[model samples]
Target: MEYRKLKDQDQDGDTNEEDVESLRGKAISGVSLKPLAAFGVSSSDRSKWKRKTIVTFALTILTSSQAILIVWSKRAGKYEYSVTTANFMVETLKCALSLAALARIWKTEGVTEDNRLSTTLNEVIVYPIPAFLYLIKNLLQYYIFAYVNAPGYQILKNLNIISTGVLYRIILKRELSEIQWAAFVLLCAGCTTAQLNSNSDRVLETPVQGWIMAIVMALLSGFAGVYTEAIMKKRPSRNINVQNFWLYIFGMIFNAIAIVIQDFDAVANKGFFHGYSLITTLMILNHALSGIAVSMVMKYADNIVKVYSTSVAMLLTAVVSVFLFRFHLSLAFFLGSTVVSVSVYLHSIGKPRR
Candidate 1:
């Protein structure tokens, strides 16, 4: 969904601009030099980098898996569920799991009950903004699924990197070199190549409506991501558990509202579980779990890691898609893919700004 694509984090939004500048430099340098991410930090910071790396890899897998499942479910046919219902269930489950996590943290850490409620409330007050963004993003992505296939979805989705970079410059007042811009351009080109030139099946020839949704999703994801990162940097000490709980609570609430608005008629006419299946349940669970994984990565890592992970996931999705979607490859797809890979690698390993 657009939620994963957006990299949106709910709760907490503050940052020491000076520290952000310092850390941003390191994040980019580390990413470029090691092609791993955030390596410019000293040994003292290695622990954090390690934490981020593990989270990045995990989220990458989870994110890609969710994409795979969505396409797989679509192809399976003879079974489906309301997109709104699925999104609502996922958010509800996510919120419940977050509450469970909060309970465990409270028990293990011996925090007082009153303080916990206060923490959660604090997060709710701040996170609703991004949570609402998530509401729209989630709905948009579901609509996108109706029009585009999995591989096309993945390729077009990588455009989020370009969106992120543009937002980074405008919102954070950061500057990028020509080289950095070129890499972003290369990513766009590769995704376009895969989408346009692929002799692949129906997924590649997404309708104009689908293209519009994907582009809008990318731009929204970019804005939402930068906003979330800024919030985390602003308040470095915020409790992630508290933040996540409120984030999903708001998300669940918003999705419920959307359901009432959009699905109420259909649901009342046909009943809520009319098209329910084990696959739908699994997809709901998949979305809920993947949401947590992404939030972790977005909080612990930076754009470099997130983009790299998303890029890798896109590649995997495209490769696996050939078998799953039964589409043939094209030369332009391979050429574009190679160019994208090389560009991302070179940019990551490029010399850090003086």
Candidate 2:
């Protein structure tokens, strides 16, 4: 298959040219045609390739759709609820689900019980540190969300890349390339443009505090990723599932305590069991998925790539928020976000594989 594709590429020397023209024709005709001839795919393998592409594209669309829904929910007047309680409950549920998932994977994969437990414990212990930081960040974020709109929060979130880059250099002794730095700058500019032109006013009273909290949250998340990578490097054989399980366990405990203390007034004001809605449920699920995604990336990919991917996620989040949530965008945001995305992608490609 590979040889045939290479041969075809060499022979035609204009495969791209042909493909572009074919695509244009297809667009103009607006009729169904065989995939094989359309893109020079061999008829014998066209079905397989079509299926693979469709599946991959479907999954991407699904994931992005879920993200869009979550962001929209936040914008649709869901921030009125108490952050601490909501996050604590969500984290707790996620931790429990993660533990269950690890157990099932261990059983199926035939991993040693002792190793699983040890790895699980490591996850439990380490997760809280970042969770604590995340909790702080989320609280600030929710506050910001309450004050500003989705676009502003999305833009500010790009600060994570900058924060992560600095922390990685300090903690992991990892240096980013010029391209990576350029991407970070672009992402920052995009975020700034989005925020500056936002119709929502900063309201001076809370914007500064929110900004401080958001930056702190970004720094904490960055450090958490670096720390998790360090831990994973030391235990290369450990399953990511086990590591994530323990991290969530520890995070749950810490977050639970913080929630109780910080939201004491809200709990009293709204009663201990307020705001248990579908939105909260979805938010918890989102947090769980995020934890799983981060752990898997840290375990399997280069740490630099892992951090850079976060920037990609941010950019995607912003774009989705704008289009789906009807958030505003500006030229500065376009140019800046483009720079950040390119820089991050370049850095990821340039990174040495483990």
Candidate 3:
């Protein structure tokens, strides 16, 4: 299929070019797809929904588990392992997993030009931009944690939802309805409220530097997500695993560079597995899986869908923490979770303005 035709079909709401081609073939054979719309649902719509639901669910689970495991792995007040080194390992692991998946697909289908590892420089060049943005954002997170408490960090982090929505509109030229814009605001507000604690003064004591770093981090996150979706959707017929492989390649490169700049001596002295335990291992796996899951969501859904998944994961993490760590769940959290739920529903059903 020509790239223009594939792009047009994507804009028409087809999740996969192969599915669109299949439907066209059936239509040519005198099978009408119009009848499927009589029940208010089409095959393509159902396929898209199924993919989004599965990927979003996986992301939610992986994100929530990662949070819990990170907390569990902390020794005294901090991690005994080098965070930079662990992040490098995570990128490396994600790259390996992508390669493994690509290998399986090749073995099953036989490698064609489409599935082959060979690609033009233009095809893979854009991926490094997001990888670099994410590297900076991840590094800034550690710095922000020094000046802001967890609650404050959560509140500030919700700003990414707004930034993502704005970037999604500007980059994709997709118009959102007024209700959806309102829902974006509600999501940010709801997440902020959920993380607020009236009894704690820590959230109120954030320094100017922390606020600046948090804002920059949010903007970087939003830009990276939107840009990634743009690239994935650019060639709808491309294998997602192939795209993931290129993405993880740059991610591994960037993170390896970061490790060298930040923690080379520590890793050399203590070795890579110095502070790794069962819980830490699980945390690394979870982190790697989450990165893959995010790429899947970008392929199957969009950045907005990812935002919703992570927001819900935050609530789930809090609920689970209450049981595992005996953490308190205040009325604010309950109210905020309710609002987040409502906002998600509104956005899911939100129509695009004509």
Give the winner by TM-score: 1 or 2: 1
Tens-digit lDDT track of model 3 for 188-288: 98988887787446766788888788778878878888888888888888887777778777766876787789878988999977776676577667777
Q: Best to worst by TM-score, what's the order?
A: 3, 1, 2
- What's the lDDT for all of these models? 0.64, 0.53, 0.72
Candidate 3 global CA lDDT score: 0.72
Lowest lDDT sum, 10 consecutive residues, model 1, at 10-19
The runs of at least 3 residues in candidate 1 whose Cα sits more than 4 Å from the true structure, single-residue gaps closed, are 1-43, 112-117, 120-124, 134-159, 174-177, 198-217, 322-327
Residue-level lDDT tens digits of model 1 in 184-219: 788777766755643455655788899889878887
Q: What is the lDDT of residue 74 in candidate 2?
A: 52
- Root-mean-square deviation (CA) per prediction: 7.5, 13.5, 8.5
**lDDT score of residue 248 within candidate 1:** 67
Cα TM-score of candidate 3: 0.84
lDDT of 3 at 25: 44
Residue 312 lDDT in candidate 2: 49
Backbone clash pairs for candidate 3 read none
Q: Is candidate 2 or candidate 3 better by TM-score?
A: 3
Candidate 1, residue 288: Cα displacement in angstroms equals 1.6
Ten-residue segment with the worst summed lDDT in candidate 3?
Answer: 8-17
Q: How close is candidate 1 to the true structure, as a TM-score?
A: 0.74
